[model samples]
Target: MVDYGQAVDRQADEINPATVDQRARRLLRADEPAAANAPDTHLLQALSLVLTEGASDLHISGGAPPSIRVDGALRPIAGWDRWSPEKVADALGSILTPAQRVEFDKELELDFAYTINGTRFRVNFYQQRNTVGGAFRLIPNEIKSLPELGIPASVARFAHLPRGLVLVTGPTGSGKSTTLAALVDLVNRTRADHIVTVEDPIEFIHDAKKSMISQREVGQDTHSFASALKHVLRQDPDVILIGELRDLETISVALTAAETGHLVFSTLHTQDTAQTIDRIIDVFPPHQQAQVRAQLAATLRGVLCQTLVRKIGGGRVVATEILVTTAAIANLVREGKTHQIASALQSGRTQGMHTMDQHLAELVDAGLITRQAAEEKAMDVEVLKQLVRRIDPTDTSVGDLSNGEIDFNDSFSPGRR
Candidate 1:
């Protein structure tokens, strides 16, 4: 049996002063009270550490030093004492409003955004093991373009469509929100239309540029997604951005909006293109599914499914699968033959459609990420291997797709090709 506690200790030791950036080291060396006694101060310091270390999230819990997630791995911040449950609650609660506190007390969980020192974070406070814990996800100050984010340039075409539903799907923390923001920014810059976005806690802040933007948050600006979307059309919106298609009512209203000739953009916590189609249809009742499918086929423009994989040296890169709803794909959705969608993606490359494995294979061939990392994110490992082999027949790293094993020793390295 393995001793996981010791393993964690070893990992923690790896994050020493020498390994951290200069800013992080300076913050660590600052004179501050113990975390147990000064929870609020420690919380701010931890948030600052997140920025300095180039981490995506900061995690706070009892019996653990505040940790930040970098490149999909968690590392404890050096020089911080382990927090107690009361301290954890106090630190996180200090930032909440009185009304928010009441809501949190009642629901035992809360989701909100916080900004400190000009940096914004999407925060969540929840109960775990009968104690309060918090997660702070750093929101980038600037919204990156699709190409900068490694999204295919073809996806930008959806931004120009006069009407139809464009869904961005991925698991949690897969940069779905970021992609949606980029598309919205694209519209804001190039088009002279009214863009209305309904978000829960509103992650990105978009100012009016060439277009008019009306952003509504769930709790503050509106009651719920269904409620805000209920009257959005009356507001004269040419482009609608729904943060996530969370329920049947929201999904129904969004579909209606798209069908009514409004360009709609939203997100779903589904893994891939096929699964995204299935999830939308599955949300309605059995009797309503067929009609929903028909509506989806008529209004759905495209789906971009994305996931982040660890880069070769450090940081992360996005691997995406886009489905550009060709007539055949629309027919598949209408007929409920969602399984055939993947096949459609395989042949629809000319139409800007590609599978997740294909993009992962491309990333490996470009030496942006290792073969192992691509394999981990691949929907079908065998298919990914075959795609990689096809991309570079001389790539001795990828063994025969028929075999179960790969030659990792010969796999991709930076500039190896």
Candidate 2:
């Protein structure tokens, strides 16, 4: 068998570093291995290095030193020599197919997943400051369930619905995709249906259990998410997952798909349930906002806002706020009452709805999280602290009101934060 590593080195050496960016190519050639002797880490080794280092991401720039992201922060590992520009080109040629390379070359940016053994990686390649650098996020072998993640039960319950849209929202590295996987897995085990997912680069690989799954990558199986959704309706799919509602076109297509009877799942980099909805509506122009909101109000099943908080044990856990679109909630959305949804979540506890602040206060009272940390991450710090009821050293029984009084806070706390 032709060794993949040797072949890569030969190919990289063929590419003229002078033609490409110089600094990166120079770094690549520094550790140039002979065609006869190449050092290639097995995909398994790559996965191991990431987990052992507690890295959120691994960077294998074409000609730069490999780096890792720890606790949502990027830090280059010490002592690892930088790869020369030619070496990176060689590695790139080794791992990526021609079509993938062409796509990368055109846009100089890509997001996809890589696999070795049982682990999966979320990969993103892009041109940065003139040099080529990429990030690979390791997807752990164990797919933590919603309960295990301490995400609200209401989110997992979304799996029970036949058709609607469920969104997982938060900043980057906040575990939105992980939560999405947990929900989809729940459906995979319980329901017998076809679930189709379109991602930039596929992440989790779910087996065909009770549900049949078809995963399509952006540049591999199809051109883009919009194209995938465009034809998904005819596939007789019961569940469709759009990796993200990133642009206006994709958002429009997703909403339309959801409206037609498919249970759509997606993610967004937003802070709360209301903001998540607003994000969708605002992505469109003024002329399209009303139509998008109306469609969202009708097809939207739920919204889960999540965050990864550092636990007392020195690891991360997701805390989430779940907003199920009840009749009142839907009415509020249809009527443009986004601000009132938080109040509805608080009062609709029996229906499995919950505001983030309520969950944060509960976490604090249960000793799962510190009160001070909760206040810092809380969207409305003043409101959440009031809900947490930090005894104002002044009064003992009922407690003295802080600035806003001991009434309630209005934000969602996805985790300990």
Question: Which candidate achieves the best TM-score against the true structure?
Answer: 1
Off by over 4 Å in 1: 1-39, 390-417
Scored by lDDT, model 1 comes in at 0.78
lDDT of 2: 0.67
Model 1 alpha-carbon miss at residue 78, Å: 2.3
Model 2 ranges with Cα > 4 A deviation: 1-47, 60-65, 81-94, 389-417
TM-score per candidate: 0.86, 0.79
Q: Tens-digit lDDT track for model 1 on 1-417?
A: 111111122233345545444433344343322222322656776776665555678999998989987656777877678999988888887677777778889999888887664567898999999999999988776776776565787799999999999999888888888888889999999999999999878988999999999999888889878789889999999999998888999999999999999999999998899999999999999999999999999999999998777766555667789999888899999999999999999888788888899888877776666788998999999998888743543553532111111111100100111
The lDDT of each candidate is 0.78, 0.67
lDDT of 1 at 417: 12
Distance from true position, residue 357, model 1, in Å?
A: 0.9
lDDT by residue (1-417, candidate 2, tens digit) is 111111121222233435323423322332222222232332223334454444567777754567766544455554456776566555544556555667778888867665543345677777866666666776755555666655655667799898888898999877777778878899899999999998877777788889999998887798877788778888888999999988988888788888888899999999899999888888889987777778888999999887755433234444567888888888888877899988898888888877778766665554444667677668788878788754443332321111111100000112211
